[model samples]
Target: MISQAAYGAEPNKDRRIPVTVLTGFLGAGKTTLLNAVLSETSSGKIAVIVNEFGEAGLDHDLIESVEDEIILMQSGCLCCSIRGDLAGTIADLIERRDDGFLRFERIIIETTGLADPAPILQTLLIDPELARTTRMDGLVTVVDAANGSKTLDAQFEAVSQVAMADLILLSKTDLISAKVTDALSMRLNGLNPTARIERPVAGQFDPKQLWGLSGLRKGVRQEDAIAWTTSAPEPKIDPLANLSGLSKPKPVSFAPTPHDTRISSASIVLDTPIKDSAFDYWLDTLIALKGPDILRVKGIVFLEGIDVPFVFHGVQHIFDPPVPLKNWIGDDRRSRIVVIARDLTRPELQRSLDMLRAHQPKTGTKEEVLLGHD
Candidate 1:
């Protein structure tokens, strides 16, 4: 049987419409990112789906179609969904486009502040009906730089949203110190090593960086995949060096502690290549025991016999098949895996991993590798 995802495809152009799910906590600058994309002149014919028109209200020249929910803007973009469930709404939009009523090159679904992105992602990835017509481009999560740390600690939804994103936009950086921003960036990176964190100055960013990120497409470059799986940069200390204890009467810092943590990240870089079966077994055992606690797992693995490195992605218990790259990108060929979880300390997770034959031979059975807030 022909797969539904391959049926009635458009000619010349790729038939699958790329959809970006935009999510963030309340006042995390999601609306700001949306406005930036909408206002940018170089953007394509993008279709936007928001939960409330009032929340995303912006002044743009209107085209002919101005329904209660769906409004076509003069910038070759369409705004949709006054209020409804996401799955049904997206299906309706696809139907309209198929029927020649709507035209757009891509789609962006701006989710509510309190939304858990996993379900939205599940629909995009596995829903056969929608999967046929549309492909999930990537998730762009907006994070408030000034208040992000506290928000992540308090709200599980915010953590999950950040954990699952393909790209994270750090907004309102100007409102906070570079040290604070650096600290927040490190925390986010620990939570999700697979995502690229970008700072948007005054809600302005290049639209091209936000879209075309679905790893399944033919147009998806190997460079993008490598970039996604690469480790995050360490936070700089020099930015915070000016705050002296004697001069400033000692500054108070809420910087992360070794185990004060409910949610934390662990990234392991293996000096030697791992056997495929051994690596698989390690992951299976880890997830089976703590699937509910594990929020996200992503990495580039270098297998013993394989010439190419494969990228692995997992959300809770569900794991996507590893994607093999055409060639290694740079000089660094070591295998790196990052895990973000709740109530699991980096040391405990590392101990479990140290037991794996991939890194074993047991040098005291302790977790030597640490990631996030290092």
Candidate 2:
């Protein structure tokens, strides 16, 4: 863990304090970047919110921000309780600042590797109270240049993070050759084209570049919507192309890799509004049976009685209540739901969703709809 004395940033007082959410896969150098920024000598006072202080056991270091840390996160990923906790923490921080207990000009939230950043971003964006004081600056994701391709192939979490990033940081360039680094960058660009790619030389880069990421400062507009919806370009070179020399030709399939063969994602769009009761029954039944296998579930639903779209985010068995959006941002009014899970298939999820929309009672022999069964 980076000591508090080592972390510093130049404060910006001219605008509303921007809250940046830092995310990446496990061992993507997030801690290293946090340490680098926090340990460095600067004029800004930045407050950092982490899941737990014991994960890396840095609480004993006697750092400067110990009292300032928000310990609201659970041992695992951020989920149901996190929305309220995050809102409360930010509100508390603002209160303390108002009382002159905190002098920080900016804030950064470092999420766990397995954590999904969508809910956190939504909380900052939709929470009326938090939005008044702090706006979402941007989402910065770190990718390990040397082994990032394999990580992305194996972990849906990594792919989602890359897909959602405003800025992709290619870390540890010094450990890999230019060819490998360039190939990884190409792969990343294929995943997200609008994100600015930054390469850190010797694990160092200017902190200023991380702030002021476009589109996230306010709410999701047409431009912000386009950033996520843009089509990814095809890779110039296959990441596994160089490995053909020592191994036999690999079998071709629709699967990404054997590592993530059990993990899959499915997107569903419903043209008609769903009754709240039917939606709840479907979600409750699905989560009750397959919660552990479900990694992350997020969607915007056009409920029958609601004029505005409702957003919901879930991790494992824990889920936050649906949050109503102010209004639909784009012309597309179809309700969209994206589910990522382990040992799951798109057909099974789509079937489950269909059953839910129909309000059909679950049959005991429905094991075929779940992963690892049929």
lDDT scores in order: 0.70, 0.61
Q: Give the worst 10-residue stretch by lDDT in candidate 1.
A: 1-10
Clashes of each: 0, 7
Write the residue-wise lDDT of candidate 1 on 66-171 in tens digits: 8756787777688887355677888888788889988788889888899987677667657678767776678889999999988887787888788778889889
Q: Identify the candidate with maximal lDDT.
A: 1
Model 1: lDDT of residue 94: 78
- Runs off by more than 4 Å, candidate 2: 1-27, 35-45, 49-98, 109-141, 149-168, 173-218, 222-257, 327-331, 356-374
The list of candidate 1 runs beyond 4 A from truth reads 1-15, 60-64, 82-84, 176-183, 186-194, 212-223, 235-253, 257-260, 271-276, 302-306, 327-333, 355-374
Highest TM-score: give the candidate number: 1
